[model samples]
Target: MIRMYGIKNCDTIKKARKWLEQHQLNYQFIDYRQDGLTAEQLAVFSQQLGWQNLLNTRGTTYRALPAESRNNLTESLALDLMLQQPAMIKRPLLQRNDTFILGFSAETYQQLLED
Candidate 1:
């Protein structure tokens, strides 16, 4: 089963969902806010994608953090922050079996389909 993780209201998530539907690809959308995220899940994502890649530095959630919190962020701190606020994590994390594709791009999705 393919699972997509992100907030439902996010524009990127919306686009990704639309693309999936248009392509006739079936996927399960897991809204981080409504569905909730777990430490173990976050850990897995961190391990697979790297904490730096998973972290959304451009998002409001990360920007709203104190300068001290954002500066020189360590893996433990970043993981904790993401666990506390999932919006800090990157959007539309698509999972197919053991493979995880982060972010949304039509070309990437098409490649996913081919794979």
Candidate 2:
């Protein structure tokens, strides 16, 4: 089963969901706010995509962090922030079996799912 994880109100997540629906693909949507995230799950994603890739530095959550927290960040620090605020993680994290995708893009999604 394909699972898409993100917050419900995020524009990127909305677009990804629309794309999936338009393509008639079956997917399970996991809302971080509603479903909550676990350390084990974050670790799994980090292992698959690296902590840097999984972290959403462009988001307000990251911006609101102290400068010391953002600069020269370590995986441990990133994980702690992400655990405290799931929104700190990138949106539209797609999972299928052992494969995991960190963000949304029509071209990437098409290529990944077309196979």
Candidate 3:
């Protein structure tokens, strides 16, 4: 089954969901805020996409962090922050079987469909 992970209210998540539905693709939306994410799950995503790709540096959650926490971030630090606030992780992390996709983009989605 395809599982999409992100906050329900996120615009990117909305777009991803809409695209999936419009394409008639079956997916399960997992809202980070309401559903909550486990450390193991975070680790799996981090491993699949790398902590850098998984981290959302442009988001408010990341910006609101202390300078010390944000500066010179390590994979360990990034994982900690993501565990504290899943929103700090990138949106619409699409997981299908062993494959993992980070963020949303129409062209990328199209490629995924093609694959």
Candidates' lDDT values, in order? 0.93, 0.91, 0.90
Report clash pairs, candidate 1: none
Top lDDT: which candidate number? 1
lDDT tens digits, residue span 1-115, model 1: 8899999999999999999999898999999899999999999999899999999989999999999888879999999999899999999899998888899999998988788
lDDT of 3 by residue, 8-69 (tens): 99998999999999999998889989999999999899889999999999999899989997
After the best TM-score superposition of candidate 2, give how far the Cα of residue 105 lies from its true spot, in angstroms.
1.2
Which portions of model 3 miss their true places by more than 4 Å?
A: none
Kindly provide the TM-score of model 2 when superposed on the true structure, using C-alpha atoms. Answer: 0.95
Clashes of each: 0, 0, 0
> Could you tell me how far off, in angstroms, the CA of residue 7 lies in candidate 3 after the best superposition?
0.3
Taking the tens digit of each residue's C-alpha lDDT, what string does model 2 give over 8-87?
99999999999999999999999989998899999999999999998999988899989987897999989988988998
Using all chains and alpha carbons, the TM-scores for the candidates as numbered come to: 0.97, 0.95, 0.94
Q: lDDT for model 1, on a 0 to 1 scale?
A: 0.93
Give all candidate RMSDs, comma-separated.
Answer: 0.8, 1.0, 1.1
lDDT over C-alpha atoms for residue 110 of model 2:
86
Residue pairs that clash (backbone atoms under 3 angstroms), model 2: none
